[model samples]
Target: MTTWHCLSVKPEELRLDTTLNCGQSFRWVNTGDNQWTSVLSGRIITLRQTDDDILYRTPDDNVGHVEEVLRDYFQLDVDLGELYKQWRTDANFEKKAGRFMGIRILRQDPVENLFTFICTSNNNIQRITTMVNKLCQHYGTEIGTIYEVSKPFYTFPTVARLAHEDVENELRQLGFGYRAKYISQTARYIMEHHDETWLRGLRNLPYEECREELLKLAGVGPKVADCVCLMSMDKPGAIPVDTHVWQIAKRDYKLSGLASKTLTQKNYLVIGDRFRTIFGTHAGWAHSVLFTADLRQFEHRLISSEETKSNVVLEGTKREVSQARRPKKTAGVTVFDRYPRRKRQILEGKHGIVEKK
Candidate 1:
């Protein structure tokens, strides 16, 4: 095993639990004992955290500059603590972000981030994660596995591999559904017209221009483009408004004049612009904290201290408290049932579906 190294970061500044699983990047696998393992930039890396540090290691010493790779991937140069302090100035942000800290955005590979988010159309995080893993398993190069995980990890596929004629059928067989064609066509488009270098170069472009470039690709709508822009392209101001954000805007901020039922394109721009007005340049990052807080999976964290104490019972001299389980239903609706019902339309002669708002 490679020797473990430390990257100093406070718990309040970075929490792997929230950052890894909060519907951002979906490649990380939690391998018990607080360790997360994944194939990043063609290498297998494992990470664990303490209250004051992030501990990382690889399978062997051959993986040079592990620290550099991690620093870049995690965007450690940015001070999340300072950003938190600024975001807390807003009452709504302060309320929702109380239980959520250390939720920094991961600067992922553009190719992986783009294609992974293409799978996110009208989909949930769990399903998106499965599709990304299946894509890697089918087309990516095999990287050696860690002992903690039984299955071998693989590098994300190159554009050439995913652009192959058989990729769409293979992805459909692996259960990608309509997203299969999007992935294949986008891959082929990039390989034929633009390359990975060209895609990554968008990071240097202005935010709006970068988004425009991404919108020209197959299956990349306004939301997906914003997602790619924020997560991969150097666009911290890019806020990708989805159902959760739309609700948060109307319910929390009390922004009026919103469409009563659906999130229209006009409403989408309105929400993103509103968040930018509230949270400043890094509105996307701040929006993520609130978005994570609203997720049903994280609802248990919002329980007040008094609520936890109330759940406790005195049994003679021994005090026992029941563990908190994730709620099966929220407000009379099943968790998945609450997802927005999107209407998928087939654009004539296009390989992808247009999701009507």
Candidate 2:
């Protein structure tokens, strides 16, 4: 393993577990130890945190200048200490921020972020992770392997790679369901009418302009566009209000506008504006921290409820229900592992392994 050290980062400034695994970016996988393996811009690297520093390893030495690459990917230049201080002036943010101190919004590739958030519609994190990884495995070039599991990592496919007609149909067969079409159509649209730099150029535009441009793509709605803006495009004020964020807004802020249980577009805007007003410049970052806290609490309550009812009968029934709801297996291939008719593409094959060329 080739290793490098990041001595500038502090434990409280960046927590790898919360930052990586918190449903923002999907390519990262936990290696069961403190390490995480992920593919970024076609380079595969494993990252782990010590008490005082963050460390990373990659197999390819010529990938070049690992320190700057990781620093940019993790957005480590952002002063989390200063942002936390700004957020703590408010009681609600103060409470939420304390629980997730080291979380920072990642600086991801814009087109990748666009397609990833499109898959996030009406989906949970587990399913989203599955879909994104499947997209990479099927369409993206294999980069390298996780040392621990020997599981190969793949890059996020370029827009050109995903723009083909067969990609849509194949993705549907691979269990992407409706999201397959969105991703496929969006890829085709960009490839025909625009260049890859089109999405990246939004960094210079205002948040509203960025959102407007993003919405022109297939399947990108306000939330998805706003997500791309906030997380990847440097629009820190942009808040993507999903159900969890909506609930947090109504419950904590007691917003008078939120009367309905469902979040309409109008309500979504209201919630976004409210948070923007409350959290000021870095509202999206603060909003994400709060949303993470709320999500964790909800998950904790769910697990506690399940454990409280874990009598033999309840446990058996839960297992039965879970199995019943799971997608049926076909010819020893479970639904999640299903692929298209085409042979899996391998970019570089050596030692019976595929790595990026």
Candidate 3:
């Protein structure tokens, strides 16, 4: 049965333009009906909300299946409204945060979300987005050419298709850099180990257990795994604890005073343990909600640090080389106070994969 209900609104101020430049596309656009559409799922899906409920639709007639998947996967009925309200009231909630620039994190596919977080390590959002788009156009199934909406945005590559050894080399051709290897390894692991049936186990496992499993993949640190867990698996306390959040905890929460020494993962946990006490089971999601709220303040703090400048730590050369050509909007480069955002959107799908003939 096709049912339409109020799921959520795509906040206009935070809506992004997904057509032109996915790398630098983080601004909001008005859909003209006091609503906006987000090109999520590697540009395979778009979501908009009406006055009451959010409408989830694919580019095809598979809306029933897709809606069921979202309902079951996200557990949308589990006091989410109350949880959102609590998040809004928390002392740490940043004033403009509850909408999170209308990112619509809940709407993204779980598998893609997990894999995308893996690309986030030691990178920036622009570069990360570009890389993700590139992977899709090169590897994923084609939906159709919709000249009306987008010229075309491909679905994300399946784990089965990306498990090829050549994926590393192919992605490297797209400027994925070190993450090319990580993506290959992650693809290989999921393809070899995660059968279709295993997807069910993802829901049964405890959030910690699932996160630990994700961490086992190459290039997936605790922070990346935590982000995947919290955003996709409903791990309410699975705070990803990136550089910006780290600073907020220290400066605002005073969980730890600024120390002269280099901070370590254990140092992260010391403060995180405190959040566990304060935000409790919802701390993980709470951290995200607050992080979204205070993004301007957090961005101000992180962008002010010096290490945001690109410093390449060669895997084997053991040589530190200065970056050659840097992107213009490198605002997230200066994060010395925290672990630092690995700033960059994923590579675009067209790079190195689809060549102009």
From the highest lDDT down, the ranking of the candidates is 1, 2, 3
Candidate 3's displacement at residue 56, Å, is: 4.8
Task: Give the CA lDDT, 0 to 100, for residue 325 in model 1.
Answer: 33
Query: What TM-scores do the predictions have?
Result: 0.85, 0.81, 0.66
In candidate 1, which residue ranges exceed 4 Å CA deviation? 307-357
Query: Model 2, poorest ten-residue lDDT window?
Result: 345-354
For residues 1-357, write the lDDT of model 2, one tens digit per residue: 343433356656887877887778987887644567887767877676543345566766444766688888778888988888888888988755644667888989997899899999989888999999888889888877754677788888889988988998999999989999999899999989997788899899998988999999889998898899988999989999888888888888999979887889999989988888888988998888887777753344223243233332321121111232222322221111122332222111111222211
Give lDDT: candidate 1, residue 151: 93
Question: Top TM-score: which candidate number?
Answer: 1
Q: Total clashing residue pairs per candidate?
A: 0, 0, 40
lDDT of each: 0.79, 0.74, 0.53
Q: What does candidate 1's lDDT look like per residue over 1-357, in tens digits?
A: 355555655566788988999988899998755578998878898877543356677887454787789889889999987898899999988776656877998899998999999999989888999999888888888878876668999999888899999999988888888899999999999888988688888899999899998999889999999989989997999999888989999999888889569889989999999999989989999998998998998887776655553342221112222244322221221111112552111111112111111
